[model samples]
Target: MDLQVLDFPGGKVAFTSKMQFISETSEKRVPCYRVLDDYGQQIEYDCSAQVNEELAVKMYTDMVTLQIMDAIFYEAQRQGRISFYLTSMGEEAINIASAAALTNDDIVLPQYREQGVLLWRGFTVQEFANQCFGNKVDYGKGRQMPIHYGSNKHNYFTVSSPIGTQLPQAVGAAYSLKMDKKSACVAAYFGDGGTSEGDFHAGLNFAAVMEAPVIFFCRNNGWAISTHTREQFRSDGIVVRGQAYGIRSIRVDGNDALAVYSAVREAREMAIKDQRPILIEALTYRVGHHSTSDDSTKYRSMDEIEYWKMSRNPVNRFRKWVERNMWWDDKREVELRNDIRNQVLRAIQTAEKCEKPPLSDLFRDVYDTLPSNLHEQESQLRETIKSYPKDYPLDVPV
Candidate 1:
């Protein structure tokens, strides 16, 4: 059934101001949900038998790959090989588990941190390396900086740096799916800080009013840049915000892969079959610096990071779960690491040596018929590059 049209209790003018004040006041303390104990035991969320051995192993593999990739990229940044990097260190469960629960046809709109989802859904290691290195073979032709990756092949919408922009775009995509009568959904991922943006409100309102087939996936990773959740808003966390929009919502222990996967599975089914919008707020933490440029240690303690690392490590917990079911070996852990490490090394080598894209690339894709102004801009850019020394090559194709 569709949600009843939302109305202002005190009518438009009075309710508008009240709503703003209430939203502001409630921002300081948000309730968080957890289906898994700190020990990684599943608390009460339902996991269907369909979440069988094969799926568990695959999820584990994806999580491992994500962790390895993050670590490798961090090293690359540290070694001055790459300009920047972001770590999904503590939230591997949010990335892999959610992707694992989705169908191939579903669209994913990710915030920058959710690369693991794309990798899980068949994004290649080489492709990832290409984007990271801004190599000639990069899909974006070195225009986008490292980690700003996208792929139409896997139905992942290109990520936008402007926070909360994807929320409305996801709503639009979901509406389109509804119009096409497609049995698929769109999942929009964002951080808790993004919840405070106007785009987030607009997107949720549009989805609720139109009954768009979208899942609003918020990774409440405890901090948005240097701003803690307490500072971001006073509300009962991101999940409760969904209730005002009439969207069915839940909060899950984001470090727990099973809990995250199970919530996503149920949300996806509902969105696909019923053209409903769901909001899932994942309670997790950011275990590393915000990016290569930021020092989280200045804002948080070593003990806090260590606490999450040792007690709530998503990768380790999933490994334990797999062991619990006797589906995998702890020794395969070594083999898995070697295989992935080698793969990443090779991909980095290939990406590093590859040239950047051609100068013509800047002008090619914006429009079918380039405007005279853009044509002139392209020419100016080419000439500027040509003026530089041969060793400082700029016009060279990636």
Candidate 2:
């Protein structure tokens, strides 16, 4: 019944006489921090001081813009104008508010659903359309599919389709900033499902060991494609995982815009100050299908989706907060929605009308000088197209 300290290879340990194991489930689960209630009323604390009229208005407006843009783009996919599309219907607050909290210098490695981050970084709807449509003027040269947006000028990395790949990459970037003594951190955004990937665990451990300044933003929207969080893991969500890696972690109500902004702002400060990683598990709902390819109703009930969409819609929630402060009104709401819709429509129309990238573009960018094999293939392709003119479209430049 005597307590004794044990020498261990790992580190110091406090010996205890009692034998106990950590339980998977706890009566007092990790609390999710939230600044506003579902009705958009600030409960225990008022965040109006930090979230001013101008900032609040801009956050709400950007959320609406993202919502509208998603709707238009999703429909465009349905109409066959674009190949594929994904909508950030309910998670608008997470995208816009978190982005507003960080400086432009901070690097962003986003998953596919983070279009709002690009929008916050001044990426126009035209750019979104160009990429989705894979038009001639598209920055990616029509290589990637829709929504794989990246802007070097904005310090945001191009989105990769592979799940959880950005997690470790963010840590590497953060480590580079640490080495350079730069005043910046990397923000890596991923879904709840991404935690299951090996990269996620590796990335967290690396960041903790290296004392890298990075924000691991997990948009725990309850689902990863068709799979629900119930199927992902059983350890009380992703926050505790961060604790296991010796990194700071917090869970916040992702639907609450002000809460997200406040949390990210403080997280950034602590991340850079301490030269460590911070994991933010944002508790929100995926109110839309995972992508245009998915029909969410097949896996989840319409009533379930409707509940989050109607009662806890992030955009509507923030709008209420903004209106309560007299920062928003119905006239502005109407104009904002209409103007965004028109802009989206015009962008889509122009993108659709634009030509595809030239055929020669396919061979460029890989190397300074094309290899003999590639040059031969290019010549053969040109000859084949000439022979079978009907097989190829004439619009692509020779």
Clashes (backbone N, CA, C under 3 Å), per candidate, total 19, 0
- Residue 86 displacement in candidate 1 (angstroms): 0.9
Best by TM-score: 2
Clashing pairs in 2: none
Cα distance off (Å), candidate 2, residue 50:
0.3
- What lDDT does the true structure give each of the candidates? 0.86, 0.92
Worst 10 residues of 2 by lDDT: 1-10
- The 10-residue segment with the lowest total lDDT in model 1: 13-22
TM-score of 2: 0.97
Off by over 4 Å in 1: 1-36, 40-45, 380-387
**Candidate 2 lDDT, tens digit per residue, 1-398?**
22465657986678877899978777888999999898899878744338889889988889999999999999999998789999999999999999999999999999888999989999999999999988888888888989998889899899889999998899999999999999999999999999999999989999999999999999999999899999999989999887789999999999999899999999999899899999999999999899999999999999999999999898898999899999999999999999999999999999989999999888977889899889999999999998998898777887
